[model samples]
Target chain A: MSVRHALLGLLSEGPKYGHQLRQEFEERTGDVWPLNVGQVYTTLQRLERDGLVESDDTASEGTQNVYRITGAGVDELGIWLHTPPDLTSPPRDELVIKVLVALRMPALDVRDVLQVHRRYLVELMQQWTRLKEDEGEFDFALALVVDSELFRLDSVIRWLDAVDGRLKRAEIEPPVAVPELPRLRRRLAVRR
Target chain B: MNVLELREVTKAYGEGMAQVHAIENVSLSVERGALVAIMGPSGSGKSTLLTIAGSLEEPTSGEVFIEGAPLSTMSHNEKARLRRQTLGFVFQDFNLLPGLTAAENVSLPLELDGMKAKKAHTIAMSMLGEFGLGDRASHFPDQLSGGERQRVAIARAVIGNRHLLLADEPSGALDSVNGEAVMRMILNACKQSGVAAVVVTHEAQLASWADRVVFLRDGHVVDQTVPPPTPEQLVHTAQQR
Candidate 1:
């Protein structure tokens, strides 16, 4: 989600100054990711520098400058939208790091740490749930935001449960060490 | 009017040292045209509360009421008849009979209550049509998709003016999209017919569709809240900071 690409995409609609682009971006994304006006202008300047967008000399009455997407900008936007996000390696997740570190500590129960985090995630999910209820017939963008947050939190909770179950099972029997996937037990070899 | 009520409801299993109190003096009421959701972890006694409220089991020492009438005063046959006529249930597995077609499945409850089969089929078809399954009337449960099967189960549950709809993790077997579709159907049923519903689920998102949510833990009602918080608040707070 490059700000430059977002501005180019917005300009694809027509000529839009920095303020208008900021408003449109917030509106379309359900204001989940609000953009600062200064940041918007900075990105627009960079986009103009890169020849992805060009500023118009023809003055529209109330605005300082109107930028339109160039052919190159259109091409760039197309490519960016089509490109799949990289998922080769896991992103740095704070909760995952915390849980892994907690598991190594002798004094703390990893399950208890997982429970604390699970409760927080559940509370966050509840907040999103409340937002959906308040919206009643939710707007498309708002609904998507709420739905994604709920699903993500739900998955995290499920992962916690899986980790807790596996940890308990490992306690009952000595776990086999696997170098690549520490803390995860290796599967037993089956007879053919 | 309150369609369902529980007063000091306590359900216990076994006796003496082995006794486990599934529900402990929990009281709740669902008004006409309202949907209430009960949420808790496993062993939290959510199912016990629903079963006692539905009159499937007698509470050891509490009162259950449906449509302002007390369950304790009713005879066994009266209670059975009440369940058949006034109460309905939707389950996680859908519980549709494989031998019956969609229309037949929806109409079974009405027909069992002594309605003419033709009349029951008519009501069932109309309900099925409302659920967007009119074209699949002749299709058997095995032929329909999971969503369709659940819809049929819901239509059957609320058929013939059965005002109290009790569901236990009704969408537990569905994907998120299908789970939401099921919730919409249930919400529509409550709105269109003024039927009161109580759904027990672990999913808070699904519970958001209800008018009120009751959280239970250790077989006791810990908290109840009307309308949970929304996403806009978080975004606004972040923006402010």
Candidate 2:
């Protein structure tokens, strides 16, 4: 998510090359988010250009340039570690959009659409649970990552159930008739 | 042979104008060593199906067979014997006898079936050890934690030569960590001991441990599917990325 801040945080420990940073990043994140070595180098270059990190090209034995966090980099990482992520705005969720669109279609039963998606989400949650079960007891990082995903999916399911309940209580009437479209009529006439 | 089979089973309550079908025309079969999970909203007949399958309740129509023996033909005593020898049950509440130690609670089934108390206690001790509860064998149900109690219950469920297990929200009383641990134990029992299991749970994540998941809706089977890919397959795909 914030690979720049992550790279800076890793460098704040000590001087490290791009490949080593990538390894530590994967390890700390519990391997859920795989970091590409090339992307790591690219972020390092951007950090160097921004003066948040300094690369010591002369101290390296080979062509691999070791990088260290600057004073500004440490300040930025510290700020990021304390700042809470922005969650004020509602996310653009595909499932929510699908349900909204399905409500307007007379031919579609919105409840059926909800059930289909609910089943899929449940299956996905199951997969994550299996992964958690297979993980070792000492692997707290990965377990936490899996737990977060499970909780997130569980919330989505709860939302779907709530919507279903509201719809049942509302007893909204179905469309009286399918709306006629002039464009469809024109296309049918041309085909004939 | 299939450990449990339901042939077009329909369970109805009341009669005439007030009749209600709890589960209608539901057919399912569970092979030995396979675990099946049934999930649905409240009053969706998930528990009804489980009870009928376990032969605790007779289906109003159709038939149920366990290990190829039709339940309709079994006499009352025969059914009781089958339940004692061939079936095991796990409930949401641990259901251990408060007065008995864990070892006695687990060995009660065998002792009821006429096994010597000493022999049953020895077998129960070994089973508790397998479940990592050997030291807790002397403890009462009230002395063990929720997870430990559930583990002891499971150990009791599969302790003897039980061929099938029927569980109703066995992990409902525990938190997510302990819940998952209970499911892991159930999965291990099914896989390692070739025990056919039918579990009724509201949590889909717990159901995912099963080989198949059956969804119920308003007294009818809505859908059934094999669970998603195994953890090994998922990890392999992630690594490829």
Candidate 2 local Cα displacement, residue B177, angstroms: 0.2
Model 1 residue pairs with clashes: A130-B228, A130-B229, A131-B229, A131-B230
Q: RMSD, each candidate, Å?
A: 5.5, 7.0
lDDT of 2 by residue, A16-72 (tens): 988999999988777878889889999999999999999986764667898999999
Please write out the lDDT profile of model 1 over residues B1-241, one tens digit for every residue: 9999999999999999999999999999999998898977777899999999888899999899899999999999998888889999999999999999999999999989999999999999999899999999999988999988998999999999999999999999998788888888888888889999999997766775677878776699877664544556666764685
* Residue pairs with backbone overlap in model 2: none
lDDT of 2 by residue, B1-241 (tens): 7999999999999999999999999999999999899988788898899888888999999999999999999999999999899999999998999999999999999999999999999999999998889999999999999999999999889978899999999999999889988988898898889999999987876886777888887788887765689877866666686
User: Every model's DockQ, to 2 decimals?
Assistant: 0.27, 0.37
What DockQ does candidate 2 have relative to the true complex? 0.37
Give the number of the best model, judged by DockQ. 2
The stretch of ten residues in a row with the least summed lDDT in candidate 2 chain A is A174-183
* Global fold similarity of model 1 (TM-score): 0.76
